[model samples]
Target: MSNSALIERIAARGDGVTGDGRHVAGAVPGDRVRDDGIIIPGPNRAEPPCRHFGKCGGCELQHVAESALADFVHDRVVGALAGQDVPVGEVLPAQLSAPQSRRRAALTALRTGKQVAIGFNAAQSNQIVDMRECPLLLPELFALIAPLRDLLADIAPPRRPVKVKLQMLDQGVELVLEGVKAEGLDAAMALQDFAGAHALARLAVDQGYGLETLWQPEPPTVVFGDVTVEVPPFAFLQATTAGQAALVDAVTRAIGDAGAVADLFAGVGTFALSIQQGRKVYAAEGARDAIAALMGAANRARALVATEHRDLFRRPLIPAELNRFGAVILDPPRAGAEEQVVQLAAADTPVIAYVSCNPASFARDAKLLVADGYTLDWVQPVGQFRWSTHVELAARFSK
Candidate 1:
């Protein structure tokens, strides 16, 4: 057997691959992997910043240096395009968010005896890692972990697991605890006291019926380009502020000076509100609460936005309706917008900005649009989730 081999690149699952197709975990590009499974650190390899890097499951590529981390993010997007046989004119450099910038995250809190553990689950397992130091979460979110453990120990049932979601709003942190039942006045008082002490923007609990607001002195909101949209409990938000700006910039550049734009799957007008200057926007979303937030914000701001609460998967805007707009922007979930892409293929919209979390799905939809008439102009890869394998991108398609 060969004594050693240099890693060529990082594969999709965060493992380093050699030119000869050998996969070595924790070996970054230029690192040498020996037959005995020891990785000799190379130029692109950097010491992981977190003590819990390998075990926490919050980060998979922490072993990779910053330069290599960007490469991995860029390659993942380009590789997905290759898989779909889609050609593009330009693939811009990848943008990776800095460590400890994640604004929103879902963590698990488990109570064992008198102690409670609160953190992300380990990779491929239900066991919680009990996050002590996370480099990916915002300081505001991580600050709650210790306090949460103490609070949960008092209220949570021993050995029972509950999900704790945290989001950074403009005012303060918005906390949501699911699968928790707080009975009697003491438990309720504890929740109120926790919220007041933490200065939480809002605190909601879900005992199974649905999310019930426990404490919200004022309506929680998130600002997107001057407009403040009321945030629903545990609403979908861009993982980082920098990532949202990158995507919004890509979308604005894609639809430059367009008289009208259509934002499909517009969650709380993330793009529509940001890019709707001097133009009319038609925003559609399936989620009722999300659409309400968008509508309320747009209306309160007196912006030129038309919102419709409709599921694009079942009733996508037809080509005839889409033709009314000069440009279309679609930010679909991981499943991608197959039905919308089919309609987009036939629409007369001059430009399209697609923001996607799943590259494979985006590539699939890109294929359909390219075959119809649109030219693949450029793509902007975003590493919002940082060291995780999750890939996201913003691209432009024009006819």
Candidate 2:
């Protein structure tokens, strides 16, 4: 057997060394393996706030200390760029919202013949982990968890997976369900019972037992800087509060002396309105609802802003369009803006700040910008989603 292939198969468990030297265990829980075949501790190992620590796949760093996680992420970003002439900045500590602060969405499975919910995906698999509560989700969300489990258990399709999506708006909580199936009129009775008992604001079903609805008496809203952003039940926004804040800070700092800014892939104007205090901002996003809501919010705040609906993936900035903005802020999806980066590099824009959830794509695009004479000023890491290997970063490129 080849030595490299042999080392690949070793799976070390429980912070200790197996008799074989192939893998060394580290104190951390989620991510331990380094390039040198050494295991390292996870970020939340020292103090995991949630009772579901180590077991819940949602938070990989539950077993490692928060401070350590910051260092670990910073190192990971630095290591990711290795020989690049990029300067590393503070790996900012995320401002953690109270447990159950997630106003976003997800679904879980139902235990067969049991009145329990199999919540969240298992580590590295689609299998759901049966859970009573998720600390990371908003506290209001927890109230629905147990009752929903009971409702599913009593339903005919007891073994089906159910989705629980909650959006907290300015008025109240909005709840929706998906992937449920029902056999008869009894399902309607069940829905009514669940809604009444839960005091839901809306109770709408999708097709069968696969869909249900529950919500608070009003809409769900969030506060960003001085603005309160209202969220619809089925809209897209950042899942973590701290992560969103950190990203906004990074983008604002990158704008520096620029008087006019163009924000691409702007969702709900999280960055546009917040950073437009002293500048004219143009936000372009493909999501109709998000753009419309953002435009309304901007007008209410009396901020100078305009919204455009465009799929940035298919069509980014043109050369002529680039010279119009003093600076640009991009918060593209995981696929990072490759074509946009090229156009910006060729344009006359003086500065650009990019927020990316995926590091590999960011590095690839950064390399392109660097090739075009843009110098990377800061590579800051934000540990927004506390667990798993996913990392969010903000970078500044100056012409």
Candidate 3:
């Protein structure tokens, strides 16, 4: 009746099926269950070594078998789209890289009077767990967590558990550390010491109110498909390397050999630059900061990318504007592109590649697109956020 034994027993009892016939394999119950009692493949059927699996919010499927998890998610998307007569395409295999891939940026909370700890928001709470290691981070980043704790000790509290966000870019890792009441040389020296010890490429310390400076003791570089992207601190970027590669490939294939393409809600030009092959790409975003990053990325790739800072929802599509492109590539937020769907339904654009993170919204939009004379050509599911109920999807719509 020790805690370990108690947890194990609970995991065992909670691991399969409940009285109501729900699958208890994953930490979150009610995930997969069929009339014949077939549990969908996911973290439900397996056990993970991390003691924090269920407590920590990072891995939703930690208790389920990793091998079967991806397909389980794929099935969910297919089911959603089936109602629209939209056939779901192949489910891209899950890219599960350990330690380094778990996050591009994380919002860590302060633990009172102890070492600095980083992991994720607690189960349904804003609090972060003081974690030793995560299976999702890169090995190098995984190695830095303990040392990062030591570095945080130098800074005074009331201002503890600073929000830290890190991203892997073309050149190197970008670090953004936020302190509520930090300032002056004390903050700079503290960050400097930590960066030197960790051999970080650049350090960005948030000075209570805003960004202080990008400490460039030395530059760090990350490689992606023979190209290098410079990562600025606090800039939005993908967390996992393998996941990004799959998404880029999906967008490229969806675009085919289009001469003119429009990338909607393009962030850092991940798809815009990737799809440009001596073609014109108009990248648009609502945020000026994101648009700047998109422009920078396009410049780095030497691709012909024209950027516009406009709210796609408010403006939707003006037929005069929509007719300029043969194809459109959209990567919208979780809400998905509702207004764009309405506009596209009325437009003459022949092709559309819609990338979404929410299946419900994608399905809702698919119904509208089908009603507008567009057919779901294909859908490729990408497990960008693994170990969670959430899944990323890319689909092509053609006339």
TM-score of each: 0.98, 0.80, 0.83
Cα deviation of 257 in candidate 2 (Å)? 3.9
Considering TM-score, which of the candidate structures 1 and 2 is the better prediction for this target?
A: 1
**CA-lDDT, candidates in order:** 0.93, 0.67, 0.68
Which residue runs of candidate 2 sit more than 4 Å off their true CA positions?
A: 1-55, 83-101, 154-156, 182-205, 208-220, 300-302
Worst 10 residues of 2 by lDDT: 1-10
What are the per-residue Cα lDDT tens digits for candidate 3 across 62-165?
66555556555666577678756665445455444343465575758474576555768887787787787677666665676676676666663643657877
TM-score, candidate 3, is: 0.83
Query: For this target, which candidate reaches the highest TM-score against the unseen true structure?
Result: 1
The local lDDT score (0 to 100) that residue 83 gets in candidate 1 is: 97
Regions of candidate 1 where Cα sits further than 4 Å from its true position: none
- Candidate 3 local Cα displacement, residue 61, angstroms: 0.4
lDDT tens string, model 1, 1-399? Answer: 659899999998888999999998888999999889998889998888998888887889988888889999899889999999999998899999999999999999999887898898888788899988989999999999999998899888778789999999998999999977787899999999999999999999988898899999999999988899997998999999999999999999999999999999999989999988789999999999999999999999999999999999999999999999999999999999999999999988999999999999999999999999999999999999998999899999999
Candidate 3 weakest lDDT stretch, 10 residues: 1-10
Q: Can you rank all candidates by lDDT, best first? A: 1, 3, 2
Of the candidates numbered 1 and 2, which has the greater lDDT value?
1
Error of 1 at 154 (Å): 1.7
TM-score of model 2 (CA atoms): 0.80
Per-prediction backbone clash count? 0, 34, 25
